[model samples]
Target: MDSNDVRRQWEARSGEYSPEYYAYYGPNDTSDALRCIFEQFLEPNASVLELGCSSGRHLSHLSVHGFENLAGIEVNPDAFDVMAETYPDLAAEGEFYLDAIEDVVTDFDDGEFDAVYSVETLQHLHPDAEWVFDELARITSDLLVTVENEGDVDRDGSTEPDVNYVNDDFPLYYRDWNTIFTDRGLVEVDAREGQRDTIRTFRTAQ
Candidate 1:
């Protein structure tokens, strides 16, 4: 499916899914890991851009930390509405665009943000990573931190770990901490693994 199709699909499920479910019960350690990683990269009053920001949980966390000038791209209208209510001021700026990551319009000139962050999001864009990464790097002046799921789950509904309900079209790609930063020209700053997999934070110089 194309970006619009993906956005429509997520829009359908947006009401059914919330930050609480994605954080506590989702297959990823999004809440804890995301908060911890951002604490390191995000500075007070820094401009930030987030891709696939669901329910704006990360934005909420940063707001509490005194970080402003925040923006995000999410395709789910329901989730975007919730974010608008949660962050009325920023939302009014049209900073949060409801479109697929690939379809997000970048009004910011090059090197417009202090940091770019994504958590448990990019893996879903299996075939679209190059485009997403290019956009992220284009807008980010400093860093790009991402948290992706990594493990073995075969095609069948059964596996050694017995984890099923896999979306093979968006299969997870496992990479070491170095791969995200060094190998990909993203400076390897720091990385940590959670209950399931790796959370790698990388940066590129201005």
Candidate 2:
């Protein structure tokens, strides 16, 4: 699928993911792990940004944990609407972008955010838009975390894109995230494989 098709797919699934389920039960296991990592490495005032943050469920978890300087980039506008309803404090306090990440991420100044993270998000980025990985590296000043579907991410796997359309209806491009960011000038700090995703944390070498 092309970038536009990927964006449209999320837009269509917006209400389905966050508005209903996440709204009721709130954050999940990954969300809790994300918060703990942030707490271990950052202060409450750190400028944090989440890419493809659907309905602020994860960001809301950060907000409740005392991390106030929050932001999100979401392609689905309805997700923002649900964010406003489900996580009102987050909706009011956090900055947000309602557009495809490839289009808006470049607008951020170099090292604009103290920490940047994504959960099951970057894996969906279409191959044509993979350049945004470098953009993400450019914008993050301190830490970057990627919680994505695990796949080939070894010595040879880092050399190229390892893509898989996990579902007929959506694109799930597994990538060697460690090599991708490390080559972009970040150093891997920690990596762990979860039940459903691989979580890797990177920090700017500089």
Candidate 3:
């Protein structure tokens, strides 16, 4: 399937994933790993850009912990509306766009954000991961936190993802975090493995 097809699938799935059961508790032990990274890498009251904020799960968590300047990018307008309405004090209304990743212009001036984050999103990127990493590098000034499922897959034949949120067509690379980010000038600061996921925290070189 093409990008448009994948997006439609995501939108169709979005309605079924409610914040109550799925967003906070459905993904297994990944939440523990993500919270650990959040506590370790994120600064108090820091400006944050969440690439795939999905129902404002992490944003809500961060806000309760005193990080107020939070922003997010979600392609599903209905989900974005729910998030915006849910967290009016923290979420910037209409900031979330229903556009594709490549089309949405981050447009932030240089060093405009303290950190950029994505969770379970990269594995589904279309046309490979080039555009995803490019945008991560473009927006982040200091830190980038990512969490993806690490599992072997049949890449050459069936384009089905090992993880639910991943896009099967792109062949998700589930290797060591150090190996993945080394060439991009991002140093892996910390890494941990959960029940079926790996969370990597990287910092840009000064």
Candidate 4:
């Protein structure tokens, strides 16, 4: 699918997600775990960019934790609209562009951010778009964090796009981070395993 198709898919599912589901103010395990990871890997004043920042939840959470330099790129305008309304402060203080991940290289300078991260994103990218990784590497100066679905499942062998848990018709691609990032000159710094997904962190190889 092309970028337009991707955008429409997300837009179609926007109504199903609300500010509460992506709330940063409340206590939740996902937020708690992310906070811990951020504290560990990201500097307090780090210039952070979230590649697929749906509704700006992570940015809001980062703001609450005193990390001021935060920005995001979200493809879905509806999601961005919700984020802008909910976290006006973030919308005012940081840049949130409605653009696809593959186009980020043109939108930002090389090494524009100290760290770049995405959670429960990336997997939804069109399987053929491996160039997104190169763009990600180009724009990140220090670290990269990705939380994505991995491992074999009942539908593991299929390479076709299908409806996922969120009811979006997007194809999921499980990547081998070790090979992908390492080939792009990033080395694994940390990794944490969860039941169905994994969080992998990487840094530029010195």
Off by over 4 Å in 1: 1-5, 15-36, 39-42, 85-94, 105-107, 152-181
For candidate 4, write residues 1-206 as lDDT tens digits.
66567656754563444443564443345555667777887788889988778778777878888888988887666666777688778778987777777765566788989888887777777655667888888888888888777655454545443435344446566666666787899989888887667888889765
Better of 1 and 3 by TM-score: 3
Q: Least accurate stretch of 10 residues (summed lDDT) in model 4?
A: 159-168
* Cα shift from native, residue 122, model 1 (Å): 0.3
The candidates, ranked best first by TM-score, are 2, 4, 3, 1
**lDDT by candidate, in order shown:** 0.61, 0.86, 0.62, 0.73
**What TM-score, to 2 decimals, does candidate 4 have?**
0.83
TM-score of 1: 0.73
Model 2 Cα shift for residue 127 (angstroms): 0.7
Winning model by TM-score: 2
Residue 6 in model 4: lDDT: 65
TM-score of each: 0.73, 0.92, 0.76, 0.83
- Model 2 residue 50 lDDT score: 95
Q: Model 3 lDDT vs. the true structure?
A: 0.62
Better of 3 and 4 by TM-score: 4
> What would you estimate as the lDDT of candidate 1?
0.61
Report the C-alpha lDDT of model 1 over 43-142, residue by residue, as the tens digit.
6667787788776776766665566677887766667566566655546643677777776645667778787777766655644334456666677777
Candidate 3 at residue 43, lDDT?
Answer: 73
Tens digit per residue, CA lDDT, model 3, 1-206: 56666556555564334333344353344544555566677677567777766777776667666666777776666666566566665556324556556566356666567787777666566544344565677677888877777575544543343433333333344444455566677888887775666777888887
Off by over 4 Å in 4: 1-4, 17-27, 153-168
